[model samples]
Target: MTTYYRDGDVVITSTGIRMHGREYALAELRQVWHRSGRRSWGTIAGRGVLGLAMLLPILVGALGVGIALVAHASVAVTAGLVGGGILVGLAAAPLADVLLERVDRSYDRGSRRREIWGRTRHGDVLLLSTADAARFGRIYRALQRALEPSRVTR
Candidate 1:
């Protein structure tokens, strides 16, 4: 039989597919499909809250400087303080954006998962999953073709 895909311990041949120590014969395989897992909306919202927290210092500093200037602080002294605060805040915003991007990447890297399932002729189910959804989909479609060549449609 021809081997269509192979990565690490997983292998897919024309006769069978194997992953995570589970195996299923092509003839015994009755169905192949994929399903998405639960989403992490709460984690996403938490990250947005943290991003706002990072901007809090800039907001509070600007408000304090405005109040100080109105209370008759020397123009030169107030300007220097305000200017410095603004620079720090301006620098912080981009840094916060970069940090949030890194955080988002890490979160997505961990959460990118999909389940590949196969139902056998005996009605037993075999399952596997990976963070690589495209790879999983490719393997599922290949199995579908190999197991049901006559049943495949254009």
Candidate 2:
């Protein structure tokens, strides 16, 4: 009669847990575990790209200032351009963070996965996974609570 967790695709009640159209009775659930996978190469590459994007502007600006100074531009102009370039580079930090966040979300949306496996008394395995960690945790913990016997008695 108690509802422990309910997400869009996963639900856990006192009687059972239902996920992705598959259901397992609480009394029959013998084991439940969370399985995590390794980070994908695409995620590593995306992080590298984001880091370079954050630093490239600053490096380019410094190179530009050096070139202008060597070309005999006035000290005042060089100084002003360097200051402006530094500001621009600082501005790019937030932009880079935003881009990194977007990339992370996109990868999570398309590729990230967390698996929850439940072994039933009948030797059947019920599996479910999702991209959202909080949601997955809710289902995982709920199932654990349902399977575990309560210590306190009325």
Candidate 3:
């Protein structure tokens, strides 16, 4: 079988999906849909605050140097601050990237919950539920791809 997505206890193939040991046939599902729960404002705001907190030192230092440079108080100070800023920025480049990535992930995962539901001949059923946006999107996309062939024939 062609595997579209596989991770942990979930797997989606050309035929259907097997998640946490339960199986659901693609043909059996009349419709598949996704819902993203309310965004966690507190979590998002906290992450934003944390990200700013992490960068506070850098910004403060830069601001100090910038003020000194604009004042033309001392040519030596300007040169020294500029060089130091470059060095510091370079040294923190990787860390800054990691921090940004973390904040981005926090926002992506800020949703309280995510769900995939399906309508079948029997009735509506809950197919998958998760708080991970990335994982939810991957699974939902895989399911859509698995259903593509069925759509074309009709």
Candidate 4:
């Protein structure tokens, strides 16, 4: 039988399975799932910087437009300025997209790690060998119980 235990409580029961104390069910888990793994914070930060780099051109173009307006440029020059601004903004779109894609790819890798951990049936199990195996066993058992179909206790 599968069972789940959380925070010293048994929150659910099905057949011979039981789930305890989880405020949220696995079915309700929706977010960037993360698992304990070896990771480099610097690499993650680098990806964030790349995303921000994509916005630089847009910011510069906006500043140019503001400067032109303040200077009371002629209509022809003002129109040209606006046109250039639009082009710059358009160009930035693809840059931002590429950077965001990279960031998303990194996140996808991390998410995959989490999925693997969750599937291992080890509760809060870290990837490291030093992690508590007993806790993971309990968690895995609880998860198993929670996932089991409910039984009618006639």
Clashes of 2: 0
Task: Rate residue 81 of model 1 by lDDT.
Answer: 71
Model 4 misplaced regions, further than 4 Å:
1-35, 111-154
Pairs that collide, model 2: none
State, as a TM-score between 0 and 1, how close model 4 is to the true structure.
0.46
The top-ranked prediction according to lDDT is 3
What is candidate 1's local distance difference test score? 0.69
Question: For each candidate, what TM-score against the reference?
Answer: 0.64, 0.74, 0.71, 0.46
Per-residue lDDT tens digits for candidate 3, residues 38-80, read: 8778877778777786676577668656866786667888887
Highest TM-score, which number? 2
lDDT of 3 at 123: 95
The residue-level lDDT of candidate 2 at 153 comes to 16
lDDT of each: 0.69, 0.70, 0.79, 0.52
TM-score of 2: 0.74
- In candidate 4, how many Å is residue 25 off? 31
Worst 10 residues of 1 by lDDT: 145-154
- Candidate 1 local lDDT, 3-101, one digit each (tens): 877778678788887888888767666666677777657656767777786787688668766765776778877787787667766777777887778
Q: Least lDDT summed over 10 consecutive residues: which range in candidate 3?
A: 85-94
Better of 1 and 3 by lDDT: 3
Alpha-carbon lDDT of model 2: 0.70
List model 2 lDDT by residue over 1-154, tens digit each.
8888887777788887778898766766666777776656786677678778877877877776666667667888878877776776677778878877876776555445788776665674647867666666666777777666632111
